[model samples]
Target: MARMKKNFITSLFDTKGKSQDTEEGLTKIISDFFSSIFSSSNPSELDILKASKGIKSRMTGIMSEALGSQYSAEEVKDAIFGLSPTKAPGPDGFHAIFFQKAWG
Candidate 1:
């Protein structure tokens, strides 16, 4: 006989010091936590330009042109199909096989 598998969050507290244990409450708490982390704090455009100026570019004219060049549909398909089908899924929860199979 297999042992019972127990997986769950017993409780979670929100910023208000309130305890949340229900599914909806827990989902809201978790969603809010991640949202806060990814939410961007608007920065000034001048600040961005100033910071970018400090960075040095190593790319040559030829390299820059090659990187900026547009790819043909056949090239794009080849690049995607070149990836190993059995590799792990990407951050988007999709494996290369997904793209290969979905390619039209």
Candidate 2:
């Protein structure tokens, strides 16, 4: 049997160049760093409806209806075939070539 080794942050340096090894000190240092990054000054509020009042959509009713319609089998097959075969595998661990060859 093989033994599993665990790794963790043993120590961290604070902004003042002091090493923090205690749990509380490490937590405080990390929290302060993230807080400094995420905190915002002079935040502005926007009214979305007022901002979008003058913006006009370019799509026509026919175009909208076509977009909402279901795709045909030929279209789906074409899309699969259009993908590059040498590309990296998807999240399911299968490449585009696999699908193209299986269903081509």
Models 1 onward score TM values of 0.49, 0.54
Q: How would you encode candidate 1's per-residue C-alpha lDDT over 1-104 as one tens digit per residue?
A: 13333554678999999999998999999999998897767768887799899899999999999999998999989889999997999999999999999888
**Residue pairs with backbone atoms closer than 3 Å in model 2 (clashes):** none
**Candidate 2: tens digits of C-alpha lDDT, residues 1-104:** 12333456779999999999999999999999999898765444555566777999999999999999999999999898999986999899999989988994
| Each model's total of backbone clashes | 0, 0
lDDT of 1 at 39: 71
Say which candidate scores most in TM-score.
2
Highest lDDT: which candidate? 1
Predicted structure 1: lDDT: 0.89
Candidate 2 achieves a global lDDT of: 0.88
RMSD of each: 5.9, 8.2
